[model samples]
Target chain A: MSDIVEIHMPKLGESVAEGTISEWLKAVGDSVDFDESLFVVETDKIATEFPSPEAGVLLEILVPAGETVPIGATLARIGPAGAATGASPAAAKPADAAAAKAAAMAAEVAEPATAAAPATASAAPAAHKGGELLSPLVRRLAAEHHLDLAQIAGSGANGRIMREDVEAAIRKQLQPAVSKVAIPPVAPVSASSSPASPPAAKGDKVVPLSRIRLVTAQRMVESKRIAPHVWTSVEVDYENIAKVRARHKDRFKAETGASLTYLPFVMRAVADALHAFPAVNSSVDIEAKTLIMHSEVHLAVAVDLDEKGLMAPVIRNADMFNVRGLAKAVQAVSAAAKKGTLTPDQLQGSTFTLTSPGPLGSFASAPIINQPNVAIMATDGVARKPTVVGDAIAIHHLGVLGLCYDHRAFDGVTTARFLDHVRTSLQERDWEAEIG
Target chain B: MPTNKEQVAEEVTYLDAISQALAAEMERDESVFLMGEDVGQFGGAFKISKGFMERFGARRVVDTPIAENGFTGMAAGAAICGLRPVVEFQFADFISQAFDPIINVMARHHYRTGVPVPVTLRCPFGGRLRAGPTHSQSIESYFAHVPGLKIVAPATVEDAAGLLISSIRDNNPVLFLESKYLYRRLKVPAPLSLEPTPLGVAKVAREGTDVTLVSYSVGVQQGLEAAEVLAREGISVEVIDCRTLVPLDIDTIVKSVKKTSRAVVLHEAARRLGYGAEIASEIGEACFWFLDAPVTRIAALNTPIPTSPPLEDAVLPQTEEVIETLRKVARS
Candidate 1:
C-alpha cells in the first residue's frame, strides 16, 4: 500500500491500439480515491473516462489531451499520501520490486480476482503446493503436453511459468526423442523471396487501408492464388418466379416486414440444384485429391459493406428452409449484417456462397468462391425479353446464373450441369406454392 | 463470380461521408427526411450538409428553431407516421435537452404498439477541439442504457456512410454519434459505399496474437496508432473497433480476449460507468478462464470538458497512456 501504483493504458478493444487523453478530472497532487474517475482517453473509435484502479495521491501526469499514445503505455502514477513524488528510486530497486510483485501475486490469488483458482485447487493432488500459481494458458499447455509442473524450470518472475518457458521445455524434451527415431530430411526454406517494393515515387500520394479492406484484399488474393477457378453460366427464363414474386411481394411484406427479393428464390433453386449435383457443393482436398461433399447446405451470402469491404454471413442448413422461409432467413441475416449485429458464428462454416449482382443490374457475373466452399453462384439481373415460346414470339423474364468453382474439386461439366439444374428449377418449378 | 458492379471510389473526409450518406438515403427513400437547427440554410454547424439544402430542396432538409426537445418530439411523431426522419442535434451535449423525447417517446414506440418509430438522431460528439463543455461531450452512454435505442459510432470514412445508411433504415430510434474531432481528420477513398454496416458487430481493426484493445469512435484511431508503435517493439496488439454502443458487441470482445488472454477497454467518455466498464465486465465474465491479466479500462476523467487546450489536455486519456498500459498488460 505504501508503494506507488502505476496506471497503464488498459487494452481498450480487440482492435483498438491507442488512445488520446481528452481530459483529467484531477490535477497533480489531488487526493484520489480508488475506482475514482481520473481522466478521459479518446481512441479512434471512442472517448471515455478511466477510473483509478488503486487509491492514492495523484503524484504525476505523464500525458496530456490531444496527444496520442499506444496501448499499455503508462498514463499516470498513484502513490501513498505521505510518499515523496517525482523521485521514487527506492521502489525501483530489485529487492523492493520483487517484494511488491510477490505481494501483488499473493493478492491476486487471495482475492477473487483469479476466478480459476477454485477449479485449479479442486483438481490438484495432495502433492501440489497450495501456493503454486500457474496461468490458465500454461496450465492447459502443461496438461496437453503431459508434463509435470514441478519438473519444468519457470523463467517468469518468482518462478511463474510462461507459455514460452513451457514451449522451450517441450522442445527440449522432444529433441532427444526425435534423435533416437528415424527422421526424414527437412527441405531447405525458400531462398529467393520477393524483394521489398521500391520507395514511393516522387509526387505520389500514399493511402492507408482500413482493417476490413486489408482483410478483404488478403482473402481475395489468397483465394485466387490457391485455387484454379472455372466459371460456367446458364441462361434461364425467370417468368415463373417473377410471376410468383409479383403476386406475393405485397402480402409477403405485410406479413413479415421484409422485401420479397429474387435472392431467396435463387437460393432455394441453388440449394436444390446443389443436392442434385453434389459435386458442385464440395471442398477440394488438393493434397489428398479428394472431394468432401458437404451434406448441409450452409449458404454464405456475400453482403457488400459499401466500399468498406464485404462480409459473407452464413445461413446454416439452407436446404431446410423453403422459399418463404429462406426469404425470411436471408432478410434477417442480411439485415443483421447491414446493421453490424452479426455474430462470429454467422460468418463461419459455409459450404456454398451465393452472391447476387442482380440488384446492381448485372447481366452476368462470376464471383470468387468463398474459402472452404468449393463453388460460388451469382444471380444476374432478370429482364423481360422477347423469346421463342411454342414457336411463337413471347415476352418472358430472362436472366443468367453463373457458377465459379474450384477446378480441382469438379470438372467443367459438373458446374455446367449444376447451373443447368438451377436454371431448370427456376424455369419450371411450382414457384407460387414455394412462395406461399 | 464476376462482381461487375464494382464501384469507383473517390477520397473524402469523415464529414463528407456523413453528408453523402444522408443525401443518398434521402434520395433512395422518399420516406427519409432531415430536421435540425440550421441544417437546411446553414448546412449544419460543421458544414456537413453544406450543399444538401440546395440539392435535396427545403422539403427534405428542413430547418428548425433552436428547440431540441420540440424538434425531437416532432421527428418522433413523423417517424410514427411511417416516415424515416434523421434529426441532427447541433452538439451531442445538447441532446440532454431532448432526452425526454428520445427516451420516453421514441425509444419504446415499437414495443408498446408494434408500429415502428424509425428516427435517426445524428449527434456530433467528442472533444479535443477545445469547444468547451457544452459543445463537446460523448453522450452515447446516456442513451445506451435505454432499451430499443441503437447507438452507432463509426470511426472510418466508409463506416460513416455505411452505418449512417443502416441507422436511417433501421426501424427504431438510433443515435448516430458522429465524432466532431474526426469530422475532418479521418479521410478515406470515397464514392463512399452506401452499403449498410451492421450495428452491434465489432470490427477488428488489427489482428494480433497478444493483447486485445477494444474501443469505438475517436478511440479507435488512438488504438490503431498504439498498435503501430507496439508492432515495432514486437508486441502484437489486436484492436477492435466497437462501431455500436447499444447492443454492445460483447461476443467479439470475448472471442478476442479468449485468444489473447488480455484485454484493455479504451474510450473518451467518463470512466465512472463508462461504456468501457461494460466491456471489461463482459470479458471478465465470459473469458475468466482464458484471461492472463485483469481486464483494464482507459477512458476520460469524469468531469465536464474545459475550454482551455492545456487544461483539456490534462483531463483526457492520451495515446502514451494506452501504450504503457498495453505494454504492462501484455508482459504481465
Candidate 2:
C-alpha cells in the first residue's frame, strides 16, 4: 500500500530531546531520493543532516529552520510522487504513541557523540501478503512446508518475508499440537525501547574526524593540560594605524591584489618586541627547569579554518620583515593555508603566534599559546569609540590586544611590559611615511 | 586452585573421553560392569567400548545378542543385585524395543520395589551424518517424559566424560545421551576433576547480554556457532548448554533469561510436542516480567527423517535456525 512517511527532528545527542532546524536542503515540493539529505539540524553537540528513508515527494515543512521541536515531532512528509496532496489528513495522525514514546525514550538514553538516525519510518502496520520479497532461505522453507507465500504476514523491512516470517508461519501451524501445555507467548514489549535501537538513530550520521582535526584536538588537549596559562588584555589606540591603512589600502590592493590589514602591522611590532625581550620567544624545558631562548623570531600567523577550527602556520625569520614585507607574507601564507597548499616545512619552528578576531567583531579573545611558543596574542575588533585625548573626548579608532602567555617562562609584569610596548609602537607610528 | 585452559594437557576427542570415563570408573569399582551388543571383540558399534574388551575381561564388558529386551532385562536385574550395571544402546532410536525394561523396570525400580538400581544407559543419539530413519532419531523427549529417569546430554568432551561419571555414581537410573556429531567432531583436554561436575547442571557455554540461547547435545554446538555469528554482527548472545535433559538446570536458564530479557530454545527433535515447548513454558512462568520478547524455539519439522542430504538439512534445526530465531528475539 502507498503510505506517506513522516521525517521527524532527530535527537542528535543522548540527553538532547530537541534540535533546531539549521537549514532545509530540499524545499517542501522537492522530490527526495531514498537516503538523500533532507535537512540539517543542530543539536547541543553537533550539526547533522538527515536523509529520507524512502524516495518520495516532500509534501510539507512542519517546523521551519530556527525552530526547535521535541524528538519524534514530524518536520516533513514524503509521499509517492505525483500523488494528490492534502488528501489524507487522517493518515498523518499520531497512530503509534507507544512507538513514538519508545523513540523518545531511546533518544534520551542515546550517547551524546553517537550519530543515531533522527527520523524514522512510520509505525503503521505493514500489509505483508501481496508483494513481500521472500529471501532464498524463506522461499526454500516455504516450499518445504508447502506454505503459500501469499498467506504469510511479514514484519521485516518493507514487508519482506524474513526468516521470522516463515518461522512465525511454521510456529502458527505447530502451535495447537505442540502447545498442549498452554504456554504464554512472550509479552509484547512495546514499552519505550533503549537508545541503542538502530532504527532510532537513522537520522544521526557519524562523520569521522578528519586527520587535521584529530591531530589538532590531541595537540590542543596536551597543551591545555601541560601549560599553566595566564591571560592579560590591554586596550590599544589604533587611530594612527587605521589612518595608515585608509591612506595606502587602495594603492596596496592595486599593487598586490590583497587587502592591507592591521594584523600585518601588529605582527611587525610583535617581532621587534620579541627581539627586545628574548625570554618572550623562549621555550621552557619543564623537565630540566631551564629556558631555551630562540635566536630567530619565527612568527606564526593564525588562519581561520572552515568555521569549526583554525591552523597557525609559521613565517620563517619573521623578525626581519618590515611593515610591507610582513603584510605580503601574511597574505601569501594565509592564502596558501586556505587553499590547502601549505607544505609541512612552512608550518614548523614558530617562536611566537598571533590570532585575530578583529574582522569577526569580537571585543576580546584569549587565544591559546601554541606549544613551544612562550606567548600568543589576539587582536580584537577595531571600532571607532570615544576616548579621552588631551583632556577632551574624541572619537578615535580603538581595539584591545589579548595576550595569553605561559607563566612558566615569563611573569605577569614582563608580559604586561611587552603589551605596553606593542600599544605604544602602534599608537605612535607615522601613518603615511610607513606606508610610503 | 589451578585455572586457565592452557594448564591442562593431553587432549582427547569426545568419544575417547567417554571411553576414558567408563574405563576409569570400571577400574575404580569392581562391581561396575558393562553389557551391550558387540561390546566385546567388535568394540561396540561406534568403538566407544573398543579397548574395554582387552582392559576389562569379557565377563565385565559382556557382548550381548541383538535382543535388546533380553540383554537390557539382564542388565537391569544385575543392577538390582547391587552390581551397578552400565548398558550401552548402539543407537538411541533402538531404545523403543527396550522401553518396557526402561520405563517399567529400571526407571521406577526404587519406587516400585524399594530397591535402588544404580544403572547408567549410554544412548548415542542425534542426526547429521546421513544416518536416516531409525539410526538418526533423537528420542530424548520420549524418555524425558518418563519419571525416575535422569537424562544427560553432553556437548563438550569434558561434559561427555564428567557428566557420565556423575550419571554412573547416581543411585537412580540415568539416560546418558552422547551427541553422535560431537563424538569425533570436538577435541578437548582430558577432564582434570576426579569428582563428577554434578548432575542436573546447565553450563553457560558462552556469556553475553543480548539473548539467552538454550539447547542440548549437538544443539549446544549449533547454538554456540549462532552466538558467534550474532556477536560479529553486534548482537550479544548467551548460550546455555542443557547438559542434563530431564531434570533440566532450569535455575541457570531462568537467570540468563532475566539478565538478557530474551530467550530461544532449540532441539533436533520435532517441534510438535517437543521438550523445548516445556522449557519455554517454564521460562515464561519463571521470568515473565523480565522478558522483553517471547521465548522462541527452533526445532525439526514434524515430518520423519529424510535420507536425502539436502532434505535432511532442510528438516533439521541447525545454526541458521538458531541465528534467525535469536536475531528476532534480540531485536525485540
For residues B1-332, could you state the per-residue lDDT of candidate 1 as single tens digits?
11112223355778888887887888889999999999988888888777778778899889999999999999999999999999989999999999899888898878899999999999999999999988878887888788989999998988899999999999989999998999888887646667889888889999998899999999999999999999999989999999998878888888898888878899999666789888888888888767766678877655667687755664566787677668756764
**Which parts of model 2 are misplaced by more than 4 Å?**
A1-436, B1-10, B190-194
The C-alpha TM-scores of every prediction are: 0.52, 0.45
| Model 1: lDDT of residue A71 | 62
Candidate 2 local distance difference test against the native = 0.79
Worst-scoring 10-residue span by lDDT in model 1 chain A: A117-126
Quality of candidate 2's docking, in CAPRI categories? incorrect
Q: Considering only N, C-alpha and C atoms within 3 Å, which residue pairs clash in candidate 2? A: A14-A110, A116-A201, A116-A204, A117-A201, A117-A202, A117-A203, A117-A204, A118-A203, A186-B294
Q: Which stretches of candidate 1 lie over 4 Å from their true place?
A: A1-133, A139-147, A150-160, A167-436, B1-10
TM-score of chain A of each: 0.58, 0.54
